[model samples]
Target chain A: MSGIQKNIIKTLLLIALFMLSENMNAQTCCAAGAPIGSYLEIQTGDKRLFSFQFRYEYNNVNRLVENENRIENDPRTRYGQSFLWKLDFSLNKKLAFSAIVPFVHQSRNTISEQQSSFGIGDFSFITQYTHFKGRFRSLNISAGIKFPTGKTNHRADSQILLSPDMQSGTGSFDFIFRSSASKTFSSLPFLTSYASALFRLNGMNNDFGSTSTFVGRQFAFGDEVNSQIGARYLLTLKSGFLTPDIGLKIRWANHNLEQQQAAPNSGGYWLSLPLGVSFAPNEKKSIAFTAELPLYQKLSGLQITTAFRLGFQINYTFQKNKTDDILN
Target chain B: MKNLLFLTILLLFGCNKDDNQAQTDWLIPFDEVLDGGPGKDGIPSVDAPQFDNVSDISFLNDNDLVIGMFHNGVSKAYPHQILDWHEIVNDDLSDISYALTYCPLTGTGIAWDRVIDGSKTSFGVSGKLYNTNLMPYDRATDSYWSQIRLDCVNGTQINKVINTYPIIETTWSTWKAAYPNSEVMNLTTGSNRNYGSYPYGDYRTNHSNIIFPVSNTDDRLPAKERALIVMGDQTKKVYSIELFAEDRAIEDTIDGTTIIVIGSKSKNFIVAYEKGNLTEVVAVTDQLPTIATDTNGNRINLDGTIESGPLQDVQLTTFNSFIGYFFALGAFYEVEIYE
Candidate 1:
């Protein structure tokens, strides 16, 4: 197969791997992925339930603009890819640790394409505390910082990765903080209403891309902060042994960096809704899968990227109380 | 109690009601809602960059002009929104002369005539913020230091604001003077786009500042503290930026994480203004800079940074080609000094 076809296949496989891992185990308090249907598990006080999870994905970096205004793909630099890995550990019902490392493979392409690429992508680490049941339903809040651990060079701007042209890392440090509130309801025998809103804070990342275009040097990515929030709902088949689920989500985000100058100071709202599914062979090991397709992308015209992320997770339930998880 | 337990169990294993349909698409465009012109909000109605002549400050073309140019087949003057905000912004390479004049802090475009004063050439932020300059036009009040005029801003003796500077020279004169030390480069010679004085070469990180003159004094608006870059769109459009820093540094105030912006006292990060839009993306640098000591013996980071693009004759959405990415459609240069 041509390199472009292979890359598309690889990207899909990576998504499959990510989704499968999310629900591989069902009993752990913090599975490989977040709770499939938004069942908030608050650590109100000292309720000890623990687990660990991780996710890794790599996207073949190739950008092609179609004549019909559609961005296309090229096979020459098929090796170019975006590699990302996530590690998560739940201390108990109330706390969790998150770490992510992203890499922009500049040398993956032939020497010709390499001439325009830039520096390495960065890494992020965050740890949050969950207040199982605070004032409302289950609420979770996490705060952490993103460090510029990747390389910074303008040598990689030529890649088809997406804009704000971050080939590698922009040597500036960024801090990220997120607060989330969720309430899940069993509205019907097989339906669950899951809603959660997150407030995210982003710091500046100004290593400047490979080119001296005015935007890169504007800040360090310059000192700025931005926010994004999303909410989702899922449907499940609560049968004897296997529990399968499906759902949707909506998200709104805004950003104001030293860049995006002509845009509104605040920003236009972006809305995204995803349909997802979750299943469990048994209570001890539960599985969740999801696909996020942007309903509307008004903010960044990163078009030609008919992009969607498929995620899967599995978690093993620990000690159970009643008949269901107890017997398993 | 049994029902409560059953309810909890149901809640944990219930299904979600959202759809998972799949389809392919680019970003939705706002051309229709945008109404082919500037919005009442002093900004483009659509956030995305417009490539045709349907917007302000654009080049002249039936499809490109939002309001047709002042004269056909010639480099036209700027639109009111562009002019109202930025009174003068100069580029030293192109035959046509443009001045983006306005102040985010002062909240006015200043004035045009040298007598009005209080104006300075508005340049783009350093990088992709929206690069709109291919050369530098020395600016002060509405008047620029003109190599075009031998007298300079002698017309305005008004000390009230920045009412004086030098007269802006034409492209040939400006480059002849700005780069007298180095081999001069001019993109306007091809005769395809012969308006304004600015350079357009291949995509790059470095080019001479092709600077002419803005005003007499620094205008007290430090380069770093001034507005970010503004890049032009295909439709004579401009994308603006309002990059803000903390109002006060740690030395200026006590313990605080306040964003620290340009105006607020407590200090904070805020978006104070917006400029042009980015069509194509590229950086220009004579030489990349790192932190170093200045000739004045002060510790500083001297970066030969310049942001420029819009590779002429290309649409913003149509910029996915390697050739388009590398071609120098427009030019921009700036020397940033940070301590």
Candidate 2:
């Protein structure tokens, strides 16, 4: 196949991979960062592109258990919502850079106490590099830094320190590492598969000066590892192509530590199933939607579980000039 | 992978203020106490308590608990519904300022006189717990006083014990019957808090375990069993309410001081008064009775006054006391039980 045909096929495979893999961040208390869909693929050819994305996520916490015992219902329940903006820029085909900025709102209500917080959440910057290329497969690796830019010093009733989960930010810097691979089936022309793995290392927040907890003691969120695999089938249409994708994502995390000791009820594991559809009218634009259902989840302690989640995105691809190689 | 390793090493070594130990001169060692989540005044102590006539109270159930206080002919009841949320109420009755402190965890309540250093002040919840007891802080010095200990454990005024007034812990129905014309705390606390629900779910009923750590434990009784406790300068005594109800009345001596514990199971009320070699004390009536006959065949009113006898002018001192959980009495005081 020609280079142009190979590039088109690669792009199609990526479109399918994103639909199945892009879902939520781990739904842990006080966790930050964007959903998986926000991750951009590394371009290996000498084609430059830029895109922007907006996303919103929400969770309602109604159940909590401690040490395997379910906590009884309280007059208070927590609701967490986040808005994120992601920017992706392909510096060159071989390298890419992406940045995400988020705003978070959290609210909790109890008998005499009703509190809410809204502010910018943590920000992340990532760089992706194409490491290898083969006859029908490509590999990319990525590294990123998450900055503690969100608001952390929020109080309820002007004096009470809200729990870390209620704060918009974790007040800590984190490091991220990820790798992904995609392959096109030679026998099945319209089919492709992709897989990816990621790890995040959380740093200690020095400003954890809440009179509660350990006074002046620092806290670090537990490290996290997430992996997913998915496949997509392409169906030809009169105007564009319709792609249906399915994937499963699994995440494992350690308990958040305080003053070098593991904080109780702070960590767990989860598995989720993502189903999605993408419709592209032409090579220049496409729209996608995904609905994630939790298949199996067993948290470390009692926690608010996700009933379901939904996400949508619109993409418009633009080239600086009509590439002579693409039109030829 | 190499870049990931390098960044990890940099972050591990790039320590910030978290690397240094914080400078805190905690009067009470850090490990002995636990943060109750809310900061100072987080639970919000009532500085101005409002009351409505018994006829106006619509929220309390007959079985709900209340703290009844009486002074200089004025009587009022503070419902646990309000205390369950605020934990402390700073108010004045008969011109005497007091901090009515209640700890939900230990089911203990006490009225502390707020006169410190000759000036009156208010108290607030410190959002700190010691042995599952409430720790109140005075606004005058920000000193945290252990609710059961009744002494400042941290901050200025350390080691100072405030004077304690007397209070009675009884069911709302019992209190209303005793003082039919008394006023009850109104739920309109101005903070827009729900007055109907308990914030901690099943906590009052689940005595199997405590949410926070306590320093001591005694298996003499269940953690939640109610006990009438009396604390003297150097002596402490406990009478289990279950046994008190079974016996109705008991005369016991502790540390060479003899006292009489009287119980009315139907009214769910208990009180202790000093006894001096009295041969017999019998009630003339039942169910909220007011007349009793002492060993000398003298008629006595509920207030321990001689209505008829040679000792007509003599009066028995009723020690200032409150009824709380058996676990709290055992946890905080060196107790001599009157079985």
- Using lDDT as the measure, which candidate wins? 2
User: What is the TM-score of each predicted model, taking all chains together?
Assistant: 0.38, 0.57
True contacts kept of each: 0.00, 0.02
Interface RMSD of each: 19.4, 11.2
Candidate 1 segments exceeding 4 Å error:
A1-52, A56-84, A103-121, A133-137, A157-164, A168-170, A184-190, A206-255, A259-267, A282-288, A297-307, A312-328, B1-339
lDDT of 2 by residue, A138-181 (tens): 68889998898766655444233445556667889889899888
DockQ of each: 0.01, 0.07
Clashes of 1: 143
Best by DockQ: 2
lDDT of each residue in A1-328, candidate 1, tens digit only: 5463354345545543433343132111100111112222222223333322222223333332221232322222322233344444555556767555443332223322222232224566677686664222556676666665554432212111222332355455665555555443445333323344444344454433323312233323322322223333333345524433333444444433433232222233334455545445444334555555544444332212224555544443343222212110
Task: Please give the lDDT score at residue A21 for candidate 1.
Answer: 41
lDDT of 2: 0.66
Candidate 2: which docking quality band? incorrect
Looking at model 2, how many pairs of residues clash? 2
Off by over 4 Å in 2: A1-328, B1-27, B276-279, B282-285, B289-293, B297-316
